[model samples]
Target: MTRSPGAGLHLHLDPLGGAAGDMFVAAMLDAFPELEPRVMADVIAILPPEAGQAELSRGQSGGLAVRRFALLPNRRGEEAKPRGHQHEHDHGHGHGHHHHATTYHALRTRIETAPLSQGTAAAAAAILHHIALAEAHVHDMPLDEVHFHELADWDALMDVTAAGSICAALEGATWSLTPLPLGGGLVRTAHGALPVPTPATARILQGYEWHDDGIGGERVTPTGAAILAHVTGGTAGTRRGGRLRAVGMGAGTRDLDDRPNILRVTAFAASSGAGADRIVQLACDLDDMTGEEIAAAADALRAHPGVADLVLVSLLGKKGRPATRMELMVYPAAEAAVAAAIFDLTSSLGLRRTELDRLILPRSATISVEGIRVKRADRPSGATAKAESDDLVHAPTLRARRQLAHRTETG
Candidate 1:
């Protein structure tokens, strides 16, 4: 296994209730509790010029007090806070740089110019890309025209950028999450009223486990989904006898009589033994399926959060019957849901599955080259950087920047 200073730190996310951006950052703070000042400082230093000042608060969620941050934007000389995912995000902010709806490219440019760590920038860009791609599909518009909408606010940006910095602050610590709960019911948005787990949220969280908790209003926000996508390394399943370090509980503003309506996270000491990391691979054969059905099946497979890779092959089966084989490489926690999807969507009754071990480097870093943010993975051999496709479009000279990225990747 690749070693590092924070090698033994592991996090278990119990998002069974629901998830949100503020909830995640708050829960993490609940773990460190004392790191609130430092994390907020880093976030403030990088707050966008168009955004306003942020104020933090300590409050109770289900009787457990937590640290939460709120953005105070000067709207007509009147400060405003988010109201249950309700914000007046018009194309015209009537002040500063937000004169019109910020397009994907423009925001990409803004992120490129911001003074932030490479990993922080790249993580933010990647999360935005996830939302952009999904929004493009949901709105059936060109990716370039798809503006940030409700996602363009200062709070949303802070939510994403803050998440990036916090993950980096953890050093080599690894992040894993449990199945997510899709809060059921209707919710308002920039694009009119939509279902809970909004189209973009559903799109970004295609492959994760979700269920209705019978709560009205949105439980999971796009920022929350983006945070999970930005930091989480899919499903890490259950930790076997790892030491519990800290438990953080973040409560949502809405009070539900049935439950506490909180998001709790458990911090654990990373396993120091063999078989610490393993993934599940499932394979099934398909013969009696239509082309349209096959296409939809492939889309469903690709959207799942736990799947690492998926492959489809055509071949001749018994009695020379033409058939196709579906091979899926998914995280161990996704086996059941993936199998259920396969059976429900295709003509498959049984599946072949196997678990394999993997060694992961403890460190996560980012490097910016020519104003382009790239996610860096450190290996013993060296480091490799990956630019988010959504924001990489801003890079004018990819060839030269790629070389610079490589050279700068060296610590």
Candidate 2:
């Protein structure tokens, strides 16, 4: 098929009810149905015949049509573990099967050895690694020592693999999600009743925004949290203006009191002018701090994650006072964290925030011409390349620096 205009492209997830591994798979597959056959084939190639068969079926949630994904067990005894829920229950009745507790090493090995495309396997492994890291953090143990009780099950593995494979297939597209819904109340687990957002899920969502829905339940599972962490990197997505290409709705297992438990994935056609995205502009004026303190503050802001750029300008403030004016370009998602960092690192009483639409050209960096790194930006007219100023720091003189930069650019 010709993929109906905008398929397998930039993805923005709306976790209307909540998110899970199956929900992620369903949403992606729903948006791009052309990928179902290959996704399932790849998933089956990795697991044994008796494990289960992957299925993508049409369903409805609160009268809303939706697509659902699940793994059905072939044998009679090994019923498919319920899909789209947290696996925290302790299967102590099995005596030795810690719900098939699989170590981080074992899970990594499985993904590595699976018969999946290189991109798919690597992406899948990275997503799963996010969960492992969360678990390690929550348990206060090293990454190598972390083991999953339910996340290691065949269903979870398949879900992660399916999500990864789909992501790989949708190459070159950026992924983003809305602020995750934070459900209230306690949940039962191996360690007894824990709060709504489990420890692992909480750890995975450290820097991301949260939307409290007041309703109580496990809204974001560890698998879902890991997928979001891998996709957005704890940053908000840019605002892009373009035609909405396609929409797919995936249903969650639970029935919520307020809204239909469905997650929506929307894909957009690539926009023009290289690229256009949104950034938060933060500006503050400080006359009390000395140059050293202002410089320190700028350094801290620059080092913060999601802060794209920072500038410090000497300007005249109120009453002809000489002050340092600080302006920072930060990702919208990281605005809160960056604002907190600014307050902690500077003596500024207040700062100004403005959301700006930024037009940026496609760019990449390459090292060449005496190992000097050059950043090349693609423009409508032509491509332009510039050598990194820091790379020329070792030049003995200004002329030498210019010569090196010219050589790097020309070559």
Candidate 3:
């Protein structure tokens, strides 16, 4: 079914609840059965032969029927080796696995050439590109030289690509999420055993609020964390006013006793009557301009490129000096241009900028004549009218002039 105009989607990342890319995708499939065939095929195609043994199926959790993607160890070939099971090997100064560096350029090309939907493929490539750029910056390597290990694996590729596909499918809608649940503990990887919520995952979760449930396991994967970071723009909070329609639960490979190991995806229809809001506010103080200059500056600012709306307010500053405070509502993208105008036009040494949410309404003009008000929804083309009451009152009438002339002649 097509989503209505004002709809939005809310996704809650339950890290303590086992956050894996496969788990999330399985849950999404269970929630939207129509997408199962496509998503399943895409996911399985990307998995290596050994990893493909794991089966994804529908199941129940917390009385809710959800998709469970269980990772079953392969019994043949290299899979014969214990998969995901910890083994003690004390030959060195600590427990760590050898991490192989996977070139970013190679990964990018592979993702771009993958057989997937256009939107999904693009998103997947974008996420990889972002990761590569970040990694390059951190390691002081060229973007092309940066290498990813676990992040470039088949499972990770599937997860990142699948998440991107899902997001692409839900475009044109706002996505809000709850504070991510980042479970605590050490995680085993090819690079050795690292603390749970790996370094990559931690870096992605920066600037966003997260809570630790002390589960001591690798609940959140780098792929899953990257997906959440890319989708929500790093903002987290509960949303209101949107009608909740469908809820999907994605179950992770491991089961938790304290809570359901699932990610929740809630589809919502935003309130149609709700108005649009602003994203930023730009304000500056100018205590050094004359009245005429201030007026001219206000006009110039209004005409300034990128200034949405300008308002000048008179106020008292320090030492009782009168001043004009200029407030400009600017598009977040245009803050720079508007600020430059303020600096050039007036002697104000500083300007304050803030982000705000404001609502606007539609309006029309009206005019009044002879005590009667007339509403004008639109401007009339080339139409003008003028009225003078005193001139009309003093003018002589034709009938009075004729009577006076006859009376005077007869006398």
User: All models: lDDT?
Assistant: 0.63, 0.73, 0.56
lDDT tens per residue, model 2, 93-164: 011233344788888788778788645776687687778878888889988788775464577778888887
Comparing candidate 1 with candidate 3, which one achieves the higher lDDT?
A: 1
lDDT for 148 in candidate 3 is 72
Compare the candidates by TM-score and give the number of the best one: 2
Name the Cα RMSD for model 2. Answer: 7.7
State model 2's lDDT. Answer: 0.73
Model 2 scores worst on lDDT over the 10 consecutive residues at: 88-97
- In order of lDDT, best first, we have 2, 1, 3
- Candidate 3's C-alpha runs over 4 A off are 1-18, 44-54, 60-64, 70-101, 272-411
How far is 132's C-alpha from truth in model 3 (Å)? 2.5
User: Candidate 1 residues 322-378, lDDT tens each?
Assistant: 888888887766678778887887888899988877665443333332334444454
Any idea what lDDT model 3 has?
0.56
Residue 96 shift from truth in candidate 3, angstroms: 12
Instruction: Quote the lDDT for 282 in model 2.
Output: 92
Q: After superposition, how far is residue 360 of candidate 1 from its true place, in Å?
A: 6.1
